[model samples]
Target: MSQLCNVLIVEADSKNVETTVPLLRKMNSKVSYVKQGLNVVTHLQKKGFDLVLLADKLPDEDGFRVLRRIREKAELKNIPVLMMLSEDESKKAAFESGASDYIVKPYMPYELVARVTPYISLVLDRQKFTDECQRKDKIAKQLDEAFTEMEIMSRLDPLTRVYNRRAFLEKITDEQIRSRRSQKKFTLLLANIIKCRHYNERHGYECGDFIIKKTAELIHGSLRERDLTARWSGDKFMILLPETESDGLEIIQTKINKVFQESSFEFKGMNHRIDLSFSSKVCTGNDDLDLVLKEIE
Candidate 1:
């Protein structure tokens, strides 16, 4: 109430209603009144309130029943419900029934104001902090998702869904550092389509693009999970086999060759077997990546 707050005041009698409503209004709170238990439930369902000043008695139902119902609701259960204790009502019973705070009353205005004010302020502050955290979490999740998508688009070839040339170059640099630290070697294999231009001329660029994409898929599927493959150029591809030696390279080459022999590109009615030429080099940790790539050229 000292800070801004919304409070629901449930009072049945005319005298108590008059006293309680004005007392809450003087504190500059957004106050709502419900003279019955059902109306209390209705107002709470339809709106958000920081605090509820529930009278100990309602015309239609016991105030404790209303309090229990509010507590049962998932959404409304957290709002601080202060019970207005009459002379006959037991404060212990009210507390046991989940009353957040209680005030004994023959309408002592100052005591009423003092008791209700702090609870309203505290609940509002807690709600404000909760809302702010939820907003920040949503924004963080959106940012994380956006960054993930941007990273994928940057690192991968859009057409073939393979690692792009730039991504490959960056990875090889990291691999070079790792190899140097470990004193282990890795192999680089570059493969080029022999007559990709002729295939494009014979069919269309779309057909040639299909061939490229399918070849990339085959090469990627042929390798171990640890091996990295990239689309180096329009008609060229490269592979990095980590912690590999000459024997490993030879074995990988045989697998790829077998895959190539079994694979064929079919357009319309004609089937064409694409030919690939491969060159490989073993890096001893210090070989310049640019110079090493030049060997395959």
Candidate 2:
């Protein structure tokens, strides 16, 4: 009784409306009225109601038809519907048409309130449960998105926006297993920026960082989509070319050398040319991963 309730009275009778509206209002219920059964669904769609007071007789259509229509709608189907009937009207027909309960016409105020009160309480409880579930679902979705973003950020190098050393090691390990199973050779290349320390001391650390970032971009752009590149150390990068042999390695090495030789970085109004030193090893998955890393590094 304390919780606010919305009730729709689908009755054409003035006497019934006068009696029912005032009594329900006294009980803290907000009431709406529609004289035609055709308007029942329209009203419910516009402003949802907790309970419906449907008279079997309406000006436009039978009240049973309106109840069935309400039951058909996905949004309004679960609302409690109380069918108001004349003494001679068949209660059996109302129940079959999906009435939650029925009341005889010319009834006492107490009886009407008694039948309508329980449904109001039930609806309010149901609404509260639904709202809580939807809230939890929204929170769960937001948490899932946040966790996914954190996982991606953890795998990436902040400056160059490529895989960091730890993530690259995991990827290369998996690729090694796959290549072994297929008996295919894959190439690993380690690259170092020539005279990187000299540039950092002469120009500044900012210029060195720019050179590193630009080199990562050039190497990433020159490789095939399947190739993986990672920032291995301060001025060193590692590349994994899956299912590649000596010819593939040579082609990639030449391409990377050409791009590096052609590209230049502008620092303090001066264009500084950059160069790289490369070492490569091809493995058929039988090589010790630690030894291979040591030899290349």
Candidate 3:
């Protein structure tokens, strides 16, 4: 009742069909006998068989042609195909036509059963494996996206979408690992607002918040794709630059100071000047992220 052993047999000779039918039935298979290749497709669509057995030579078409048609039909492409080849069959043609398995004529029922059973089981197993693989791939992709989102939420500065303190440390750890293995350069910056606390006390919390967010924006916008910025904490920030040596850190420090110097934010409809005191340490020979961050701090 489960219909698991369902099969469609398409042997052109009535004698071959006669010889094969009882074997298939003995194996608990449902069988259909066809003597012409022309009818295979229609029968294939109607029966929706799990397996197909064919004689290489046919009245209307060859086994290869039927195989081609089977492949062309999207619904039948995955159905397993077995062909009965002659003693001098074309090995190349049979293989190229996508014949799943081949048996020479004058074959024994026990031998036929032996080869065909594994192939059927293989097709079923492959289908099951392929289905499971696709399902897992889809699930893995979804989970990767979700994990990235959660990481962004947890470790990014909200206003500027830069890495925050936790993210900064994680990135630093990654850089340190990379540097230890290779001769690569890494850099870090410890920056603090000169009078950000004063800005809060005198101008109110809202004004202070605007000042912090504005400073964060300038730093975030200045970074290249390879660079990372983080909200180190309130009134503090850290930056990590990969492939930047000691010389590069100097240029980067100058850039940071210049950006802060030229940029001004308004509080209570009045322009408020901001100042940043920042330090940079580049990972060169014998430099560690923790040590470099401490130097900048």
Candidate lDDT (C-alpha), each:
0.87, 0.90, 0.79
Best by TM-score: 2
The residue pairs in collision within model 2 are none
Clashing pairs in 3: 163-230
* TM-scores, all models, native as reference: 0.64, 0.77, 0.49
Query: Of models 1 and 2, which has the larger lDDT?
Result: 2
What would the per-residue lDDT of candidate 3 be over residues 1-297, giving only the tens digit for each residue? Answer: 122456787776788788888888776577877888897889889977888887788887788888888888888887788878865456567768887877888789997899678755665576677778988999999999999998778877776577778777878888877877787878777778888888788878888888888878887777777888888878988888888878787787788788888977666779987788877776753666566666787
Candidate 2 lDDT, 1-297, residue by residue in tens: 145679999999999999999988876678888888986798998997888999999888889898999999999888889999976456999999999899999899999989987877676676677788888998999999999988988998999999999999999999989987999999999989999998799989999898899989999999999999999999999999999989999999999999988888787898988799999899878889999999999
Window of ten residues with lowest summed lDDT in model 3: 1-10
| lDDT tens digits by residue: candidate 1, 1-297 | 134578888888778878887888777577888888976766898888888999888889989999988888899888899898886456887888889889887858998888987886676687678888988999999999999999999999998999999999988998999999999999999988889998799898988998898889889999999999999999999999999999999999999989999988787777878778999899978997778888877
Stretches of model 3 off by over 4 angstroms after superposition? 1-148, 285-288
The weakest ten consecutive residues by lDDT in model 2 span 119-128
Per-prediction CA RMSD (Å): 7.5, 4.4, 10.2
* Deviating ranges (above 4 Å) for candidate 1: 1-53, 57-79, 84-133, 265-270
Ranking by TM-score: 2, 1, 3
